[model samples]
Target chain A: MNITSAPPTTDRRIDVALPGAAGQTEAVAWLEGAQAQIAGRAVWSEVRLEIGAGEFTAILGPNGSGKTTLLRVLLGELPLAAGRASVLGRDPGAAKGQIGYLPQRRHFDAGIRIRGVDLVRLGLDGARWGLPIRALGRDRVREAIELVCASEYATRPIGRLSGGEQQRLLIAQALVTDPRVLILDEPLDSLDLPNQTAVSALLARICKQQGVTVLLVAHDVNPLLSYLDRVVYFGAGRAAVGTPREVITAGTLSRLYGVRIEVLTTADGRLFVAGLPEAPAHHSGRHEHDEQ
Target chain B: MSSSALPLAGLSLDPVSDFQQLTAFPFMVNALEAGTAVAIMAGVVGWFMVLRRESFAGHTLSLMAFPGATGALLIGLPAAAGYFVFCGASALVIGLGSSGVRRHRGEESALTGVVQALGLACGFVFLSLYQGVLAGYENLLFGDFLGITRGQVLTLAIVAVLALCGFALVGRPLLFASVDETVARARGVPVRGLALAFLLVLGLAVAATAQITGVLLVFALLVAPAATAQQITCRIGASLVLSVILGVAITWAGLALAYFYSEPVGFYITTVAFTIYVIARVTRAVIDHSTLLRRRPEIAEAHA
Candidate 1:
């Protein structure tokens, strides 16, 4: 494939009559009552959440909460016992090629020292196995490398790069397929301040510039406050979804944890929710939401 | 004692006679063909074995074939075919019998352990039943490759060809999934199917290696070359290619040295492969230091 950094077609008109277009901007999910249990313990009970198309949504939760489990169900990696769910108007697993996913903190084996652009090429060309020797038509591969700003490191081994560089490489690998929806699990976990800002701005640009919907799962919603379009708080076997401002409020926060939660907003109009039951000890300083 | 009657120990032998002893005899040729074929198959499959961290699976399959080979010998059938059959069966069990890897509670080695135990135990039971029924039990521990037949050689060739095809067919996906499963799956690659297929290919390779190297020496063929190659190369494609080249070179080189030195083939191969891998590791470290010293200016320029 010819990998390039060129912007997408100006027309953005895909005349191939792709599926799920009729349902554009519609809620991808309509769960009346969804539940998941493990060893007779309910992780999620009577929970309902709607994921809209073309929306940059963030799923926020505590460490042991069902945010990840919910994402697994959404990605069709796990099955729900009593629930109806759909992605892109089809079963989540069936809409496989249409979504891009980045797992949390996965370290590639040091044995392989592939370049960043080659990793991106894999997504663009699908997979090549058991076939005659053929490169991905060269040009597409170059184009994909460019699209992700990974061409500079196209020849550098991934292991030699820094952690933030590796994360960027992974993001490029995840997005090279031109997927409709991109899902990242804790993309900001180990990034430095500069990298956190860089990646957040990058994702924001891709969403606004390319119309690619984003779903980010993060435990620390503190970093994502300024850039996210909406927030979905998963807690106590349920979830609360609305605009970040509306959902991170005192009433929503207190109900989510079954304890008093105070949201402090600085003069800059950025909000941070703290005083939850899980971390009462770290309740001294008000968290700054716009620092990164 | 007469010179011929002296113990044939601590002495080098005539290289040509030793070569004849290894191949001119009918049984010796059988071993040569089998050994060569197994070495090639192991080289290719070993690439994936290293990638998947399924070296234990190779060991387990080698052990799992014990009963099948002995049972075949006890019934006066070809043990080579039996080994291949049993290895394939063990692979199938390992791939499909266990629940999904995600269900294994936060333990990476736990699933590997369970699969290893199942295969080892089943192999032990099979060997126990056929104990003392074969000509020599020690030969199984340290293979007597000279006992292999022409039919087995042909069979190994076919197996190697199939494995080569399998590797090439799934080379892209296998590498993709091993390096990054989430990205591969999102891009519509069949991660689970590729994993299962890899296990099966590994089983086949393990079976072939066990027949010549003995179950104990399968590690030498599967791990040593690939591990060595990894130390020397940062490129995935180059690493795999070099691993196979090194594996085949070690096998042939070891065989030649064994003939000249009258050494046991397995021990000779292992020693040579280990030495090469160690040297490669040391050389890579030195090269890294030198590159850093020399390329500082280039790094500064690139950043600018």
Candidate 2:
């Protein structure tokens, strides 16, 4: 437990040194003693964390445990109640163009007529006024679709595609801006097992090849366990951050949950948590009650 | 035939002569000009309104036209002024009450229904309080294209131009926000502001459209053509252009039919637009069914 305390003096020094440094090794997102509030009440407080550039991190927790809330705080949608937070060497939302975000899984209505390619293009310049110039941003849109391996059906209407295909195109949309930081919420919630693994591998590749910082929220972390550089687990207004080997152990999780718990490992090296009174164990092929 | 009934012109075999005859009257000329401007604006704005699935909100705004016009008549003002005031004000209320990324959609719909009910009630009250026979009351609900003056045509053109300019400024961002609001907001698009602006622009378009199609039949120019175009194409640019073309064609057809048959232009416009929407739907269904039939053999082979 090498948890750094409040008042991020080390982060301040790094900020001062950022101009001279190459910027690749800097912290992509820094949160010190951060408290998130909704409707004047604190959802979670006393959070201290720092994520370096290009690291793939997974946020795992039960429903209402503030995993999504932390992402929202970092996205600058929700203001922190107590502590300080910064991303990409600036305020939470000041450097938005350099960040790509995939929100919670949403099904496209069957009547939506926009093509998958156009939807991805919106991610690049949808905020701009006037009609889109067809020639502008074409190459990047193509590159993103190809990277996601969705070139075959990217021309089709988004509504007509299957869930997995739509998910891939949405990932392409998030990646179209060539962002340095990628934040996704429940990206794997409705995906099947095979699709879950494939999407995870794709995200891992993006992190390694592009050096993009990836912070994703998930319920079951098994699909992302092999690729994660670190894990942040939230429980009852508190959070624990460490490497998977350090954080997924019985001792750490039981202490975080304030209950007696067991971390069981399968013969194939998969880890699962059992003995939680309210929530089910984090197991594959079992559905957890969704609180969306 | 009643002495006051309009002299109906029979359709001649010569198309050019019929067009010349249709344009010969100043009132008909004004109606055609107003209809063209209204159609173009309605097509573009209505395409977005339908895309956002805010047609109900658009409908509520149109309903405001009734009260606006009658209230103006009661107060000794031009009905057009009433239309713009009531529609724009109600649009602001709806937009302000329900401008956010997600959630509260039920509340928005409920608010729209309430506004619609109040608008109708206000219209009836104004009508009863006027204490005079409001001649051409039927024309207020169903349009009176033949009664349009040249000044009214100019007003519609100006409003159409301004509304189209608004679209030019926010079209891309509006489309993005409408399609995926959460991601749009995450990417720094002002989702709430855009939503409110779109509602305001839709109010302007509705107010302008209600002038020609009247309150009850604004959907003739607003929803039907856009919906039909969407049903026919998946591409945004193509669908928008098609929607405009369909709207203009429907308006022209309704005008010509009304001139020849002595019927309300609103009824003719609504019928034409509805028929076109039905055709588009049927054609799409047929194409999809054939595609499925063609793919069945491959599925069977794969299974075997």
Candidate 3:
């Protein structure tokens, strides 16, 4: 098993570098020969990638393709079995709270007694022990809420808000930390088309404005295509990375899946892939703007 | 109705003087003091329990009271020591048994049920084997608030302070984890450690409250106030404060009603708590319905 791939070894980095600007274009998250272990067996192995700072990347994979496990590794919650994974140019576990994360949609119980702002405030100092002096943390929390456009429902019960509204609040929670890298797992799942687009655009804006790297895991790539700068598609314990147009092509995805897969493009430039065995099961019945 | 036939029963009907006469007894004063301490501890800890959806664990800890008392009688130790030992031990059993990644509700529930059953069996076994009359069975099961001694009240106060201070130490992180464990874990909150610490605090609360309301009716104090307050408000600080106030009110009023009616204090306490919870739920529903009714007109106008 390869333990650590040589540093300064990446296919994704810009080959040309300015003498004084090395830090600006460095890869925020780098994985080389990474193998993710589940139950002592490698579920995904030999993954190599470099995610640049301020880049918007989408992680696309079928169910059980280790997409979530890969995110967990970057969050430092999971250890790689036989590779090096560096986050923000340091050991991932040592960089706690430096990476803001939005997990999949989680609905609170109906009787949940918390305001939307409180949820975001937890993102700021929720881990701190004792009663939070809201006076000290309120300003930062307010800025986060404003950033996500969630001020209108900031005072409402979190469980009472609509799905789209709740997602915005969750994004605010993720942004409250002013993290260097944002890791989101299916942030747009169960959302309507408009909400999906709006959240994706907001995330892209944050990335551009703050120079923060974003690694988002999603089942489908259609909603995120417009804002995504690159794509990491995982299949059968293998990984591929490139621009969306490059990775989602019939030639690339078909070879990745070891099956015939069709990449369908609509008149409006939206891309969809079909003919994979799991495509039928993966298609959500919700109305989409285009069909594959 | 039979109370009317008693010669002195009619005198108990005056609400003001009846309250005064009840507090006139020294034992009643002690009972009130102990009840107040127990109510405060329960209200604070129970709010977190409900938020974490750990009511089953709370119930299991309360059930330990039965074995604690019976085993104390069997081994010649103080019942208070037995209560703390059994409760603290059971908390570890529940916490350690199910403390893993988030989303293991099935295994956690199974562990709670198993612990509760074994604890109840031990209580029954201790009761059968002890040769002396296990005289406090009624007290153990239903409680005798009026029989509380000064020492018991002091003990209750000390336990209340300890539990509340412990809560003060971990309250924020615990709240964050309870509301959203995934985000809390992602942000480096000690989610698993917080779960274990909360279970221990909940153990202290169950041990304290079981003395006042008994093992069977512990939920009367542990769950009712928090549930009622949550129904009325979604703000954490206000809801927690409201839960504490509601808890104290229910205990005090239950004590008074039990005095006037010559009934079991547990019965009055549970009934009053449930009644208040019902009122809060109904009021919340009515408010929601009215808001919906008011919104329909505006929605229609916008469509027009």
Candidate 4:
């Protein structure tokens, strides 16, 4: 089987029709042989994927594997070098209003004095000019905070909150817009294991209950493994999308990375992809050293 | 010496008479008008400048007023025109040269420092090149509230109004971009454009404030009130309003005291602003310590 091509047997490929027309299907995002380049170098090319409505998907890769590049392509921040990609049945940038996006986690300086609730409100009308009118969309902000289970400290200064608490508020901020598609970039990076699992479960529930398509980028696959409907693995200028079981096997991953990698299952049935020579041992270190 | 020529109306316990004495002369009235305008503009712009952590840039822009005034004098132009031209041009250079990303903040600070140094150097060069001794040179550095003309007050008022209008236009999106730039961009906020626009507004603010507090003590009106207000409250609206109130109150008090005593208005303004900042900071510390102490026992009990 050609691993580079789209999965032939899966029903996902059948939804690939017009670029900007999601006509009848529930496909929220569609990419056909899409390629993205950064600084004149192709980071990921020949990407073929279709994410349906209410589905929870994770984009996983080692550092410099172009997971973020792919997200930028969808957000319309970066132009696709070749092929076509669409979000919410429109061109990438055109459908931004319906797409809730959480950028990479950032530390709020302790001196930042804005209330957490105010931050959530910004997600609603932050793009609009003029001052924020009080009580406009207040209930929506409160509902979003309640949804994230962050109502306890929503009134406190955002900088004083813990990382997990801040992450929940940011998630609420993203959700306050009532987006049809939620794109979160490395939301679980700085959180502990329990918080990671909790946030992952929260995203999954949002996907199922609110019928919001969830696309999360992550480095580690274990916390999100069970909740993810599909996995889009990026490796050395290539991408593969399938169910976790299909795309994460040694045979598929080895072909994607062009190296002999091993997928091992622990006693608790948690799968670990080992033998990634290019992957950094300490992922956080890689982020810190990355040229901003 | 100048006060000896005018009636020495010292401040009294009665409030109405002190106000009457303060605004008795045309020059004093003009000083108050210009001070009020400058204080209001600085309070509003400085709140955002402090929030965005760009006080260095603001400081550098304030420094530009010196060279701008001197250069304008050398070329036989109005000092106010020089202040705006230099401050605005330097602000554009700093804003355009840096990406305003958090990662490049160190580089931004360096660029700000470079502009500040070059501005000071240009000021001294202009002073040396000019044939005549610069009249009111001390006023250029430490400010002369009594020297503020009615025309200057009008100019300051007009510039302050324009800056406030510009701020009102971009205030919300600017706050969003300042607080969280990456997500704001994704939400379709023009982050880069807002950064540039904010720098320009801040340039206007610095130029106006420098006329009152002078280049050396511009932070007296620009940063001190905003920093004090932010220390006291976390709410954006409350903090901003408090900043403006504190700024206006401080300016009035400073002007009154300078009128009563024989000192530069800048000295009194800086001293009062510093005192308020210290009080606010100490009060905030005390409250924070008490809250932490109160929470400790409960946290221990919960753990137990």
Model 4: how far residue B73 lies from native, Å: 1.9
Ranking by lDDT: 4, 2, 3, 1
Cα lDDT for residue A104, candidate 1: 89
| Candidate 1 chain B weakest lDDT stretch, 10 residues | B1-10
The runs of at least 3 residues in candidate 3 whose Cα sits more than 4 Å from the true structure, single-residue gaps closed, are A1-25, A257-259, A277-292, B1-19, B100-102, B293-304
Stretches off by above 4 angstroms in model 4 are A1-25, A279-292, B296-304
- Which parts of model 2 have CA positions greater than 4 angstroms off? A1-25, A39-42, A82-84, A277-292, B1-9, B292-304
What i-RMS does each candidate reach, in Å? 2.5, 0.9, 1.1, 0.9
Please give, for residues B1-304, the per-residue lDDT of candidate 1 as tens digits. 1112323332246666555545545755666667677777787788777766777767777776676677677566777777778888878877765442432313534555676677667666666776465664655655555456777788888989988887777888888877677667656678778777888888888888877667667778888888788777756678878888888888776655544454456766788888998899889778865666566777756656
lDDT of 3 by residue, B141-172 (tens): 87667668899999999999998888888888
Q: How well does candidate 3 reproduce the true complex, by DockQ? A: 0.64
Error of 3 at A235 (Å): 2.7
Q: Where's the lowest-lDDT run of ten residues in candidate 4 chain B?
A: B1-10
Best by TM-score: 4
Off-target runs (Cα >4 Å) in candidate 1 are A1-54, A76-94, A112-115, A125-129, A137-141, A154-160, A235-240, A251-259, A267-270, A279-292, B1-32, B65-71, B100-139, B145-147, B183-193, B289-304
Tens-place lDDT digits, model 4, residues B1-304: 3553667767799899989888888888998999999999999999999999999999899999999999999999988899999999999999999887877889989988998999999999998888898998988888878778989999999998988888788889999999998888777788988898899989989888888888888878999999999999999899999999999999999988889888888999999999999999999888876776676788656656
Residue-level error in angstroms, candidate 4, position A33? 2.1
lDDT of 2 by residue, A140-219 (tens): 99999999899988988898788889999999999999999999999999999999999999999999998889999998
Compared with the true structure, what per-residue lDDT tens digits does model 3 show for residues A46-85? 7777778788999997777778988889888899998788
lDDT of 2 by residue, B1-304 (tens): 2112755557788899899988887888898999999999999999999999999999999989999999999999999999999999999999998845557778899988999999999999999999999988988898888778888999999999999888888888989999988888777789999989888989989999999888999977899999999999989999999999999999999988888886788999999999999999999888866665665788656656
lDDT of 4 by residue, A23-123 (tens): 32456888887888777656777788888888888999888878998888889889998988878777888888888999899899988989999999999
